[model samples]
Target chain A: MIDLVSDPWPLVYVGITLGVTALLAYVAKLLIWGMMRQSNPQITIAAQRLGVSIVWLVGGVVAVQELGVSIDVLLLVIGLLGVATIVALRQPLENFGAKYFADVYTPFKLGDTVRVGEHEGRVIEINAMSTVLLSKGDALVSLPNSAFLRQPVVNLTPQAWKEVVVPITLPGTMDLAAFENTMHRAIARMRVRLDRRYPPIFTVKSRTAQSTDLLLTVMVRRPEDRDPVLAEVNLRLTEAMEKAPASASRAASGASAVDPGH
Target chain B: MHSVDSRWGHDAGTAAEPREEDRDLFSDPEAATLATTAVPAEGRMNAVSVLINTQTPLLQFPRAPRGRHAMWEVESNFSRLVEGEDYRFSPGGVSRMVYPLARRMLTEGVWSDVHWVSLNSHGPEMVRLPGGITLHNVTIQPEHLGGYGKAKEAIWSTVHGLNSPRSSRDLFWTDDYGEYTYYNRVTAELIRELDLAHDFDLFYIHDFQQLPIGQMLGTIKPKLFRWHIPFDSRKIPAQWRPLISTYLNSYDVVVVSSERYRGALRRFGHRGPVRRMYPCIDPAEYKRAGPDDIGAVTTKFGIGPNDTVVLVVARMDPAKAQDRVIGAVARLLPRFPRLRLVLVGNGSFTSASSGLGIPKSRTWRRHLEETAASRGVHDRVVFTGHVSQSELESLYERCAFTVLPSVREGFGLVVVESWLYHKPTVVSVRAGIADLVTDGENGLLFDPDRPRALDRQMLRLLRDSGPLSRKLGEAGHQTARLCTLDAAVRDEVRLSGELGEN
Candidate 1:
């Protein structure tokens, strides 16, 4: 058997693979940290996990090459598997993507009366695959997420024009009280355009170990200002999430400092 | 007077005589219907989720900067506080009466989830109190603090019938009004968020400062508003009436402290379910002090053993009618030379720098001192300036009788305190407590507006050493039972259950 450890070419290949893998892992971690610091923790963690798995996959191939395995056939097999998986899970993936977009963009929410296509009823639920509505005639209408994109939906909720709902996802580790405080202070800056009677409200929708989902709702005084207000609110939401962890840590430290006994 | 008689005594057909315009105005069914339904069911228990709001928090800590503690972390219960040093229970009707009622409802499991949002500038963002109660604090900027103070003062003055109606219209349009609205808006927003989480059964809002919160909340949930101030329809400006009524109509039920206030609300055209609930205090909190305790308290205030202590336990404000007590004391000084007047309280949270930053207390106290000096009764007056509860009890025990001389008091809790101590009280006619007092029977009732009513009442109490004082004290104690927490808890639990049924 050849002493592969002594060979210069094999040693160089091993070093290159290990070095690149470590560098890639570090870079991926940094990106994840930045995203988690700036965006929703759920999104950041999801992206991070995906990035780490991809880096490990590529690193494994490099390591195999160092061990003198043929790479062409392996690449072909992986590509074929990827294509097959994509084709099989297309519908679920589409529905998931639609749900994500609907959370951010859809004006009508659960409990709101909405009209989409031939269906008109109070929106009872908004699930991953369909938006459920209870019709006036006691029939349940389940519309696909794709229909919301294709059809023109009219929200019949009184003062629906004034309502702006923003979806927020926070990491389980993030302190809710701190996040709420920062969000309140951030939204207060936009009080000029927002209706004084109806201030911004954040309602917790659901919670899991990975993330806590909340809906941020604000009412605008003028109909024309909705789009601008939505954009501004989104921008603030992004900023608040980014600033939250550090501010939360700072607040915690400040509290502890003020209360030494604690 | 004849018109009044004709309208009330005759039938609809007979009432319509000669005045065709009046008949036509009364004949419109739609207008009449609107008038009758204008107030709506303000008092109906609508089985709705509620949000209770007040300025003072239900729970307060003795120490400052209670940082980084969990919402449930309470180191010491209210009993641990040494009344004056560690913490002083917040004064005024809201803290004394309103909070206990809310707590009782929660304890009785009448309310689904009672969320109290308050202005605790010094406390945490949120405190999860006992019985699933959550306290939300609203913080205002220091710069806007002064403006907010001025705005609340204006509203207070207007509601108490002190400010002229002409000046009140401008109040809604001022920059201070914006800040005032900002505080209320933030509170409303908080309540809205909480409602989305807990889906509360109803919103029971208290105090005059939080009046706009009902309109701002915009929830279809049953809202019960309790106005804890003197509501005089005649005092409200004509231009301000529509706006005030708009806010009042937002509530399903509008509760006032007195029937007099209910009538005033009707005159102001608040056609809602206006109910009268007399403010109450927890009698369990008051204990009769021993003679030694009384001596210790009076000695601290430099009250000699021979001196007759006349106590007035009220915040240092012109509205409290402290000047009336001072004037009455000055008048009776020559006759009863040993009489020592001990004014108990200082400024409220609004007048404190750590709180709302209002200076009315300081100004009013200064005016009072000047009046005392000018009248040559400064030597006899003892401004104890915010005594502890124990000290207050001692003073109540040591004094001949107590007086609530407010020009317009919402309800007098001090008289109730005097009653709890089995001490006779001389109450101002303007106080809501006067409704409970039957002149010389339970407690003395005197018109605050009269120049010598308070003086004569003071003399009457001073000269009487016979069974009359003891008889009045016993009767006053009986009246005090009507305003105790035990009675209040029963009424509040019943009200909460009734609301849940609706």
Candidate 2:
């Protein structure tokens, strides 16, 4: 009470930093999401999360310093902890990173027969750390996720080369069935490049009120058309998402506005 | 005081009531069989939600009155046009067979919500029914509807062994096939949307026209397909096998109408559970008409007191082999001068103006009229086209016997209808119901391919009309109980409930 001027300024400064930290984090997430519209949903999510974490960390350091707490030892401890975590979890981090790439590039999926090194069986599952195979004799074969990148894996499923499976995640702002129907019509126009016997199929992996996870599968008429077909299909899918129905506003009530392509 | 003939101004005939005679057809009308036995499903775990998909909509809306609004955009209150005047319910197995099962299952507390999706080019988007049932209709563009019709017809003709192998070669790659896929995709989209909202416990799809729907759905939910037509594996082209198998394997279970078809499904390489259940009917729906009904029917058709009524109740189509029965009727008319042939029915919904509007049924009916006229029996033949349920029951009661002469039948519920009336029936060997007939006991079996065989069967029934008719009629009444709602509904509900629980 007697020295209110000095006390209120420090408290007010800390309060301002806290409020500013929240605003900065929100804006940074929006910018990251806007810049990554064309990227995979996973990458967009990761970038937004990383931006928020950085804003909070810097703002938190300043707020504590305003509170008159020494943060030198705290900064040193946090830096050392980050380095130690990277070193200790190096193997798991590699597997996790490899899983991200394998999801995008791997030709085989669950239920495909794949041969990695001397292992040969039907692929039962693909998890973060390993891929599981059920052998012909009913034995289980688990292989490391990193092995998919380290060695050449042969997919022995019949006509597997013609198959192209794309994983897609629809945001709360997009309608899945409407998006799928439009995506199918857009892809059917390129029937000359696709196998007529096998039409494009969109399968739901899982769904929530917030989002829907899906896998879009198309069979290419020729092996060489795979890359172009993928690019064209992605463009069509992104357009479908962007052109969501008006009811989509109900689902994504607080969705951000700007989306510049990644 | 009941009215006489032509109540609705349907025919230009006499309105006088016929004289009533002694009418004692059966001793016991309630001929209960073992199949009619009931089981209390107290152990059924939970109420389920079901989604049924078919090619034909259960209710077809009328084309909107000139252009007040499009039919598809109209509300389902059905105010624009009258139910019977502008549009009529489809009269065939899909409506007759599926509707009863759905209703009975709902009544028995097996389901919480039941949604049926089907193709309806001219219909409202949604219709709510009694007992928690909802109907969804999916429309395809009219420009593409013609192509869709052609593709389905080709597939139908091929599967029924009517089309030659050469015409069916590479049929799936044609331009029409693309339209067919388009129709199915739109239907799948509608169903997926409904499923997302309702979260159905199971999906029940029907027939070859909508077979690809199972594969297109890609739902991990339990899926059951009922192949309502004939399933002769040898008839399907080798080129179509791979794709057909892919569609069939997508379903958790496939149901065929006969045991022979079950064997055929296995031979067709369907790697799924195949169950053979008889197509059923509800006895309560068919009530016996009183004397006034019989009198009005006789007066309208101009039946004499001593004239024998030989009934052939079938839709006017070549597959129904109505011409074969007409031929048999001509042969018997010379010996039994009292014989009068009553052909009861018009074209099916496929031939109706509101439906797919195929002209095959109309064209075949014209051919039948020409044949009957050439055979010099047009005067003796009575074509009572499209009667009401009460009128049909009166005809069934007035008839001395019934005949089923289909060249290839999926499963003849008409035979079951005839049996329910306690009437002797002569069945075609090619019909699915022929498997249910025991040559001389419950019913007589004849080959529709051989008109003389049907002719002989007709003669035998004419000679020994008393004991033979009564015995066969009573035995048939017992057999009819097997196909009743009380029995078949049990199997149907069990299939759904167990699959849902798993």
Candidate 3:
């Protein structure tokens, strides 16, 4: 209508920017994976997600700029909108972010008894918004998940320190039995650092069409060995995953993710 | 009406009417469901769907089903295949007890449907039994099966108190243990797959071989585990306590064969609902063989008519202590010159050619033969590898007495079979059934760990002065009622009903 075919360079440049951004996002994902290969897989995954998101955000801004938009004004408006949203969802955003941190960093799990500040009860549920506790008198107590991060929480369960649960996420098509067998053999090699009485056990947390989530639990002999054992088990799990055969179609429906100890 | 025996203080005789306990066990709605093809009442819960996992397959196919016989290709009805020719019911507690129980429950509509999963390497993927029960056979590579068999055998040996030196306390750390886990995981995976379709109401797992399955299964559904073997806390290694307790606690209910085992489970730190259910066999499956049947069995085994046959029906394994019975027989040979010991049974599924193919049974048999020969009693002992059910019944009828001489024994169902024939038995003190025996009243008890204890007990039966043997037999026949299928069904019905409520 307005002689749009006269100069298609802006559209072409925008398309090119998006194409390069995709390639860069993939490269960033690989770099994150390689760099944090020896670290906890959760950290690696989070970093990879963060890296790709930043690449896309920058690429999107550049693509928009190629359409003759003012970058300074667009970014100012975007920043203000993001700030306003965060302010509006401050409580929920805090709780949601805290839940992610608590999942990886908290000492207690769903079944463990814990004391946070003046509150103490058996944890019955860990939901998106709040952690529910069943009191000894049969009363239900709901606490904000963000409280777990702010307060010094003490796990009251016996030998809670000995437990180290590592979370895992795998492709739905991975051979779970073979992966489990490989993990067992790998964990067995570190028996000296582990409590011989309790072997490594994997529990399925959830499953989906694309991925399975699992939690791998191991008991350490000494409290000091918890962090090291967690790191080493994560490393071993990654190695096992790398070597895992691509087919466990039988158990694909029961794939799972992992989390640290209760 | 059923007569209550004063000595036992329980109904020892069968009646045409359901017993009082049976009425209480199966409610009116359940009885109504069993009586006719009718649905349960409005308030009553529907019949439950059960997923049963056991180590023993219900039927053993000589080879894997293929082509037209493949499970996916057919309706999976196994009635067309002639049993014993195309397949055979596995010779153990599974076929003897579990199969009949499933059939009875199905007929009664106690269960809506049942899917039984077992490790049967050479069998079809699935087979539908007569009563609409689906059998899911789980197969693994032979090499993996070999490792799994070794680990299971080691656990068996440990639990039975065989105490082999090579049986390390750190068995969970071994590579063979990985294979054991692999098998359980595969079975659990299969069960999970089935649960998706059937949405089972309960999962009942049998024996120690599948103990880890309760923990491996992610479902929050009710799980019941039956520990079939001897479960002595002292016999279990200290290193195995935590893992064993963890696996055991994962179940909603844990059932053992004896009160002693229940106590032991408690002592072993199993903090769960523990119920003691005595292992049972269907008495209807056994028949009192006639004189002609006994004669045929005697002739086949070359046993003389004058011979005082002492029968021992158990698989040839070191734990069974068949050699101990041979030693006792050797000691009593001079006293009773015509004494012939008949050891009937070959190997368990683990030792079978189509199974894991472990040669423990064969090795144990050869050792037993050598032991008999060394004691100058080779010809006196008849080693009938394995016999048909009819042959076993005939031998039971022909025997003067049966002896269960084991270092450690689970509830000895063979002793119950011996009691069925009204044949006095000398049961090991370590057996779970020993709790039911009153020394001189129903059955004789012997400490297999003590030297000459079994011989002394056997001598008591051989040298019965008056009505000692007959009185013991009559009393034992009463005790046998406590271990029959009817009694088991009552207990099982109550247990499953309680599970439904919770």
Most accurate candidate by lDDT: 3
Global lDDT scores for all candidate models? 0.71, 0.76, 0.81
**lDDT score for residue A88 of model 1:** 99
lDDT of 2 at B141: 64
Q: Sort all candidates by TM-score, best to worst.
A: 3, 2, 1
Chain B TM-score for each model?
0.85, 0.90, 0.90
The parts of candidate 1 lying over 4 Å away from their true place are A1-262, B1-50, B59-88
Q: Considering the two chains of model 3, state its CAPRI-style docking category.
A: acceptable
Per-residue lDDT of B298 in model 3: 90
Candidate 2, residues B178-209: lDDT per residue as tens digits?
Answer: 67776776677567667766788889998888
Clashes of each: 18, 0, 12
Residues A1-262 of candidate 1: C-alpha lDDT, one tens digit per residue: 2368576687677788978987898799777766555443445556777888889888988888877888889999999998998899887777777777777777889889999888899999889998899999989998888788877989999989888887788876675555665566666667778775554555667766567678777778799888778767666666666666632321122332122211
lDDT of 2 by residue, A149-249 (tens): 99999999999989988888777446454565567668877778988666676666766667777888888989999888877776676667768563331
Q: TM-score for every candidate vs. truth?
A: 0.60, 0.75, 0.89
Between candidates 2 and 3, the one scoring higher on lDDT is: 3
Per-residue lDDT of candidate 1, residues B1-502 (tens digit): 0121121224354634533312321234543453333222333333234467887665443445344344323223322333334334466548656665665554444445566777766555555444455555555556555766788899889878788877775565456665676577656656655665667777888888888778767677778888888888888777566568868888888887787888888887878778788788765345556777787887788898889888899999888988888898988888888999989899887786556767889999999999999999998888888776667777888888888899899888888888876789889888877888998899898988888988888888899885778988888877876776656655555565555567
Give candidate 3 regions above 4 Å deviation.
A1-19, A60-81, A134-139, A247-262, B1-45, B65-75, B164-167
